[model samples]
Target: MNRKFWSIGLLAAVMLISAGCGQKPGAAPDNTPEQVTPAPGGQTGQGNEDPTSGAGGASTGNEVTKPETKTESIKSYYTDPDVMELVEGTANISYKEDQDKYEAAYQTLQKSDNPDMIPLWEKIEMKSLKFDNGTITIDVHVPDEANLGAGGEAFAIDAIKKTFFQFDEVKSIQLLVDGQQAESLMGHVDLEYPMTR
Candidate 1:
């Protein structure tokens, strides 16, 4: 009624000067402005990471994992080809014993002490020895007055070709002095040729 108290004191002084120019209570509060959550890859932890990756700025904490490959097996037991074919078929040639090599080559040509070859090998006699292929025929038994000269028949053919070529499959010798084939058994070592040493 006094113009309605001067229009309610000019609308309460324009709402106290628009609430004193807005906010004030330890301020920065403008209704909706606290959403500043953008520091990953939008990258702002201030510098030095993507200069083509020295990998130090972006990862906020735990992730390093890696280990898995395995494989291994090459095998042995002395090259087991079924135990090397049973030690190469029991080390070849197994004659199950008893071959004192032609009775030690007829007791080394009957103990030769050469008394003109002791009555020509006291009636020389071996008769059948046989080895073949790698040679060893022997069959001696020569009689007819056991002739012995030319160094007692080259010491009974170099003591039966050095005692059956000391066997390893007898590599040579063939003298058949009595069963034939003779060009010299007392003139110079050559029982129809086959000695090989």
Candidate 2:
């Protein structure tokens, strides 16, 4: 009886070791790269051939490409005397570069409208825009300071600030009048320092 038990135990251990060594019937070997599904419109992974490629598996080079562009709809502010507050108007702008976007914003601010809003940018010309370290510096050519009204000056600054600050990248603004920094715009808000959003 003891000899029979020992033989059965040894046979069971051998069967278990052999079972661990071999793969199941249909399993594939490991370390294989995963198959990637092709992107729509006949685009495939880099260095991979597109199955839908024309004769001889050669690319037709007629794939539709999307334009690289950045666009934003910004609001320009104007003052309403009835409410004694700033009113906003929207302008859609598309640009390939950041400078173009800034120019578009300035142009939108200069547009004229009726009693609901005041256009303070009529006499002001945007000279340049500089962005550095989350701050934007805008240089403008202003007509004679003496001719600028106090109310207009304040509304102009507010409109400019509201326009640029619409972008999340802009944290503060430094205003320059004709390449020189002034103490204030018509004795209203100080332009000597940068204004935060």
Kindly report which residue stretches of model 2 are placed more than 4 angstroms away from their true locations once superposed: 1-69, 81-84, 113-115, 145-148
User: On a 0 to 100 scale, what is the lDDT of residue 91 in model 1?
Assistant: 10
Tell me each candidate's TM-score. 0.20, 0.59
Q: Which pairs of residues have clashing backbones in candidate 2?
A: none
Q: What is the lDDT, from 0 to 100, of the residue 96 in candidate 1?
A: 23
For model 1 the local lDDT of residue 168 reads 57
lDDT of each: 0.51, 0.73
Clashing pairs in 1: none
Model 1 lDDT at residue 183: 84
What C-alpha lDDT, on a 0 to 100 scale, does residue 86 get in candidate 2?
Answer: 67
Give the per-residue lDDT of model 1 (tens digit) for 21-134. 774643544564322333766554434335433354444433232233322221111111221210100111223222434544455445333332232355667776666578
- For 98-175, candidate 2 gives per-residue lDDT tens digits of 877888788887775565666667667778888888888888777684334666677778888888888889899999
Q: Estimate the overall C-alpha local distance difference test score of candidate 2.
A: 0.73
